[model samples]
Target: MLDLAKLASQIPGISQHFQREMTASRQRLERAQVLIRQTHAKQQDLIELHEQWRDRLIFSTATPVEPLDTRVPITPAPYSHSVFATDGSQISPSHHEIAYCYLINIGRVMLHYGQNLHPLLDSVPEVYYKSEDIYVAKQWGIRVEEWMGYRRTVLESEMLAEMACGWVNPPGPHREPNLALVDGSLVYWFLETLPHDARDRLLPPMQAAWSQLQAAKIPMIGYISASRSLEALNFFRLNACPHPTPNCIVNCSDLLDAQMPCQVVSPLRDVTLWAYLLEPGQRGPLWRSHARILNSYEECHRVYFCYVHVGTEIARVEMPAWVAEDSTLLDQALSLMLAQVYKGYGYPISLSEAHNYAVVKAADRVRFFALLEQEMLKAGLRNVGTSYKEARKRGSIA
Candidate 1:
């Protein structure tokens, strides 16, 4: 029931607005490219400037491990390799449901290339209905869905760790070069907004999972497609800052009404900026993320990332400091990832298959509630009922 005619009528104005924005964006992109080229020649000074202003900046930034403009061609993938990927889906608790509970389903995949062994496609589903399970300090106004999200993250990491550990010590004498892949950023930046108690609860378990992967000597990667991260651009902006004394708050206060010198790069993200510089199957330089959450992580578990240009899209690939520091392992990871992307026709095949297993469809949700209600009734709980709003939704009387 979208009003297509009305939407069509507004297309002219929308097109006009889009044109103006695109024109502005193009100008900013040109200026940013110029700034990047200029800074590349003075890379040492920019690095010094970053080190000097590292403390005063409020936002997360990146430290370049190589020249800012470095573009590495894709390394050749190994003849044989195994990829373990894990993704998760959840059912958010609804007030209209017969019970106050949520479920997390982790879809895991193990794929071996250049081998006759079959791939493993599986899912692990767990339900949480206990009062403690649904509430991570409910008194602080934390919703069940929010708590479940963190729980799912923990569960996904644990599952990935289990797969990685298993890969490290397989039952048979056959083993291929392998890596563990997850579908999002490893940094728990959102944890900064939570209380200390919540942080203590979540961080330790996640770190423990990471420790397991590290102990297994597995290269784990966090892949993000169509990434909008500003870490790289922000780093260049910090270098582009014209103030002699760099104080993000005070030095830029006067320029609030006008465009600041650093704002020249504001229109582009790290991915788009690199797309112009990198050819297909190439990767930009690695960067160390200085997200504040890393303070809670061990030095070995600190996150590093790079932009990879696949034929269809630019992706942000993240890994632990240890993986990035090891040149051999890093090259293996990037090559295997590129091969997977080519197989998937733009995305990683293992991650894509894992997502297929994790996704919870509308029919599945309805069936889940029905089964829950049936079980409750079988247990002699006669008071189970849905909210009036839910009832109306199920049977609309138009």
Candidate 2:
């Protein structure tokens, strides 16, 4: 139902737009070279703005390098490591269907490196329709999908930690050291953006899961691919700033020192920055993020991340403060991640398997509705007809 010919005419304009943007981006990248050549004294100075406006300032970054392209090489994955990954999928409630129902399917995978030849896989689907679940959150102004996503994140973390708790190993060559890999960020980022009252309802259980995982002592990594974070770029701006109160509010061009190299650096991404900095199998120095979501974590469980070139793509690897502080465990974690990357085409194989397991197929959806209708009829309740749009979509050829 699209006008293909009309759409074709706009292609040239879109191409030109891309070309224009590319030219600007190249200029910005050249400016970022400033991060590579700065002195230690310039890199470590505090801005004067911190004295006056203490409320908005968060000084968590500790990366002290110039040309912004710094690197440290890491070893490969160990021979006897295990990686456990979990992912979730959901079917949103459809008012057009016979019942107001939603479903969540969690898929988990455990891949062992040395001793085990076969990887373990599992999928669990939970259906929700309880009055409290559907109505309570909605009454508080949370949408159904929003509430479901929150629950799914909690479940994934809880399950990953619970499994790690049971893992025990005696010291040996094949001693199983479990590494829990989360498909996204360690923190429930959505909660940080919500109103205090809204997040209050969700943060407790999520925090509980994080605490459990930290107690388990297994190294956990949250892999973010094509990460959109600007934390690194923000640091670049801070590094080049020459003001007593170095905030971005002042015109950046005027605020930058004449000797600084970052004047050529545009507002680029951490991924691109690291891509230029890190070699294959290398990771940048760890930096703690002052993300608002981190405040909900247990005092000892703050989250931090570092950039790594996993051969093909530069990714941000996040872990708890506990994991970051443990040098041995941290090494094992990085090694396992690199190994998983090697095993997979590019990403972690365990996460890829878990995602595939969690996906809800279209054919399965059709069968699920049929079963729901049958069950209602068996309960002596008449099945409610679906909406006309849905009915038309399911029109019988016969």
Candidate 3:
């Protein structure tokens, strides 16, 4: 059994560490606030910020997508519209208990404003066991493909895109101007971290899916709640530097320490920056994401993002440039997003339903194995065994 008493004693020490970290974080937060105060409402400051972002192409940075639209007021959505949201869950292969297999399942829900369909749901599940699909070879050696969760991210994009494919051709009379929502970033942000060969292998499917969604004329969004991304704050950091150059990264780390004029908002996130500026139902202006992987996308499919104040929290919403550029689709998407948030009691109802649809409970996994074992026994094969340690825990004294 665990040592509950000892764990309790360690609480004070943990609390001490947390307090120190908060003190440091607060200082940076203050600096960030000061930076914003100096630059807010200044046209020249925005221009300077833009130039710094564009100049530093070495690292990811955001530039103003519109002349100066960051302060656009919130606009109410149409009275009626349709929304679709998708989410997924997975069961990974484990040598400890289960067979060498993995499963990915997706769930989707569609909602029409002020109306309930008799039924509104979809699901897809796939299992994988092929050797090549189950493992990846790294510089050190081969390991299960699930190690860093790279594959799952690809699967998410692939699933969402695939599910949205049918709508790609043209809008039918039956279809309403619709908004598609996913519970994460529009881009496979992790792909950039993978080795080139691995990245190359995973890129095609995601691209194809996005292409289909774009072609369908659907404005799809990736929603992240309480996000910590600092795209806008990073621009402030660049502007705060006393000595500005094309390559601020080269010496900025050290420079920021000595001439740290921008400590007030040092660690500020984009949502936090926008939070102080936006009213409920308002959204930040669309800014192109600095994610380098987006460069590989077709011109129309490049990723853009905005911060939406959903009453309870600020959320980051990402979409392809094609969606962002379309005024009619963009407004409807924002309106529906806001409505979903309210319906969900501070979350997106369709996404929450999709999550519920795809979740795999532990009892479900046990039943799966039980059924498998029963079939194996009927076929004259021996029962599958748990690991020796697991067996011992289950009363196997022998």
Candidate 4:
């Protein structure tokens, strides 16, 4: 028990050292918090600046600074009565698939078919193709063989286009050139897919087909139905934002923010007036008040997406814009027509639901085609008049 006060003094010195260490740690943490806050503020500023630059790139109102041809065809042409429609679908070399169907009102019915011919032999060892022991000529032959497969597929599409052209020329009896409805944008992606040699083979026929159609005064209109996957819609939405005039610096992110999910009409006042009005919770035929407009417009091509509730099943119908104005009679008639076409077919929705809106779903192509085919047939058009045998043959090649 001797010198108790002296021992207590030593303990106080150690305790003071611990306190100082804790104080230093607290100061470092505060400094780090301050740095983080500064970084976050700078990041936000950069994001705003980037958005400004993007808007200007997409929507420039000024007349294109680049020179453009302004020439219009001088000679006017006559028209015909028989309308023809054509639809094309392709399975790519990489197994990707796309389909476009359209009506050509002017030409005779034509069918084209082709396929990629590359044999993907799974059993062949990779070493056989890559071996150093193989001769140079053998390696070259293997490469050539591989390329030939792509060339074959390209040739197939060309052949089909040519076949279509052949059907158009020297009009058949009881059939006159009228109009051609193609189910896509006329941007020539189909032609681009062919090989140079195949393109050369197909170009002349395509040119001849165009000339014949033009001579017949049959207007060719490419109509792209409402495509959710298309970038065009995204761009349109961005350009036509809630603002009366879109600012140049705005991009998709800004547009996305302005859009209301599942709402067809945008917040933009001007656009809201111009575009079709969709009533909330309204469940009826998708093409109300649009049929007469479609039938009356001979040369116009339009696109629209509608949320159609057929009972409990909701379907998003991407189709050509068919309505010019509100017409109750026409709407009723169109609804009747749709009901007739879809009578036996099972709709995804139930009878009790007030409104069933259409939603986009992956792998809905087969159902879409079936509905389209039924509608077209009901509209007094024979699409690809092939019998079971012929269809079977076509299916085999595909």
Candidate 5:
């Protein structure tokens, strides 16, 4: 009874402490509820996305739809006998080089080639160059000889084809019935390179060659060696990554090991491979029949081991299994030839896709003659004393 006022004051302090605890507990409960709601929302979102993707994949078709055919009948056949393989290499005074090679049996042949124009100057001008037209003109001037040489090689190849066809169909002097093998694709390269004026002159020869081949019932097929750049692109796509530049070197096996499938644009209605595969034609509806295999382990192996060391660019997109298989066989043949020809010199010979072009560079043409001689020996033909140096002196180029 004497301390009633002090007791009342103590009661307020105790009430305040109780209120503070209640408030904190309530705030914590509300925060926990908010967190739980957010987690559930995230989980639901993930589930929906997973379901959508799973459904799409389950319903999507596995192969491409066949394309309508409008062109003439063209079919591939197996080799019979007497196949001819041809190749060409181009080296400029500036050290920029290219090689094109191919093989043809009695049936079909494919030819391929590549060119690298090394930068004329290592360093660029400091100031911003304003002469666009003039710059282009200058650049063309520098590359004109190379372009001409390449064109000439293609022309020569066509001439060889004509010669082979003439030999096979009706049979000509110093010619026997044999399959003409060119180390390249079709006549597209020549057609693309020829000037409008010169095209008229060039077309007849090419047409004549093709006609002769057709008359002989010889099928023409192109073979392409696996390229690192091509493999890099394939790996990039398989892993849902960006395509690599030509300069990039990648471990192809590692890419396959990832086992990831990319979201590819469906080129046709029904093909998964077609999403990655390249075809021949430019315009019109994409054809499934023309679709070729892309991103195979075997192809990657070949690309890594064979083409990478030789330094080739991946130009064409689609790679057919038949072509790849044939190319490997051709490569083996060329390798055997190289081993036989340059046994002691140790000068490694590399075969190109276009025209089966082989390259062996030296200080002078004497080395070339020796190589030619060796090739003749392997072919069981006598050296006819046709020296490359003599040909050069006479203004007769290869």
Candidate 6:
């Protein structure tokens, strides 16, 4: 029961508010676009400003590796290449359930182009029911769902690296290039906000996966669709600041909200900027992220990203420093991504396929618990029972 009539009554007010916001947003976008053009005209000067403010930036900003306005057109993809993608889903332990356990299912795909080998698609599902595994969330001082999310990310990275390592091209001088892709950001931004012990526990294994991929020279990328990241927009704001020293504490501390100079470019996102700047199949210049979490990552594992226009939408694509620094690999990766997007008609096909395998539907969950209960009964654990609330939600009498 949702009250549809009540919700419908609020639609007019919601539309009015949204319309007002859109009107304001359009004005901001117009001003921001003008600033973007002006900034590009003097990108060299902005680079100097970035160098000066790189250390003092209070918000996350992108460091320009290539010139700010540099846009690279998509090149032709390789005749033969392989794309590997991995995605994961989880079932968090619920107190209302019969078992105190959780599960992680990793769906992986290896798609080969212009090769005789068949595509590999499968999922690896693991259940964590041991006492140590079940209570680890409490040990980490976080909610079970939150802990599972972090663990799932780590597992996804490890699984991607494992599959990439096992990939072997057919024997010939014409051995094709292959790359790995994950669905979201390579940088775990939340890690920095966690407790020190938790941070220490998580960072090592994540870095270890990065190391494994790097050592094997397997180029890995993270693709984000409809990204709302503000790193690039924040960079523009830094450049547009009107203070003499551009120091937040010294100059802009007491300024009125209306008097702020960077307000000209405020409330713009990197995706919006790229949509206006990039042509189809073109990628904006790569920029290194100055996110705090990167401080814990190794130098080679530092996250860098660029925006790509896949003909349908602007996507934020991220990679490690190792992939970004190598020109050949970077070019190949960009082309592979574009090809995948073309195949998918907007998003990457491998990722979409992997997601299909990873998703756990409600019916599957019901079957899982039913089987678990049966097994528990076979083991003579008759005390197992579903919580009253859960039972009531499943079936109710009139």
Q: What is the C-alpha RMSD of each candidate to the true structure, in Å?
A: 1.9, 4.2, 3.8, 24.2, 26.0, 2.4
86-160 in candidate 1: lDDT tens per residue?
A: 999998888899998889999999998888878889989999888877875696677777888888898899999
Tens digits of per-residue lDDT for model 6, 1-398: 78998799889999999999888878888888887777777777777887786666556788778877788998978878999999999887898999889999999999999988899899998898897776665765787788788888888888988888777422345568878899999889889878888888778887898788777777889999989898887777765787766566566667764466776756767898788889998999899998888988899889999999899999999999999999988998889988999989899999999998998889878988999999999999988989999999989884
lDDT of candidate 3 over 8-81, digit per residue (tens): 99999999999997788667666666676665546466556666555543445665565334665556656656
Candidate 3 regions exceeding 4 Å error are 1-34, 37-59, 67-69, 114-116, 136-142, 145-148, 165-170, 244-246, 253-264, 393-398
Among all candidates shown, the one with the greatest lDDT: 1
Q: Stretches of candidate 5 above 4 Å error?
A: 1-80, 91-142, 171-179, 187-195, 198-204, 227-360, 363-398
Error of 1 at 179 (Å): 1.3
For each candidate, what TM-score against the reference?
Answer: 0.95, 0.87, 0.83, 0.27, 0.32, 0.93
CA lDDT of each prediction against the hidden true structure: 0.85, 0.73, 0.70, 0.33, 0.33, 0.84
Q: Candidate 2: deviation at residue 266, Å?
A: 3.7
- Local lDDT at 204 for model 5: 55
Candidate 6 residue pairs that clash: none
Stretches off by above 4 angstroms in model 4 are 1-177, 188-212, 223-226, 229-245, 250-398
Q: Give the TM-score comparing model 1 with the true structure, all chains together.
A: 0.95
Q: After superposition, how far is residue 46 of candidate 5 from its true place, in Å?
A: 34
> What does the lDDT come to for candidate 4?
0.33
Backbone clashes in model 6: 0
| Model 2 misplacement above 4 A | 39-41, 47-54, 57-70, 169-174, 195-201, 247-264, 396-398
Cα deviation at 306, candidate 5, in Å, is 22
State the TM-score for model 5: 0.32
Candidate 4 lDDT, 1-398, residue by residue in tens: 47988788799889999899767655644543343234334543433443454334342111111111111111211122222333322211111211233111111132111222221111100111223322222433434333333233333233333433455556565443333434333333344444555445444554444444444433443333332232212233332244433443443334444343312322222112212223322222222112222222233223233333333233333322322122332233224322422432532111101011112122434454456567667887754343466456547954
Model 6 Cα displacement at 25 (Å)? 3.0
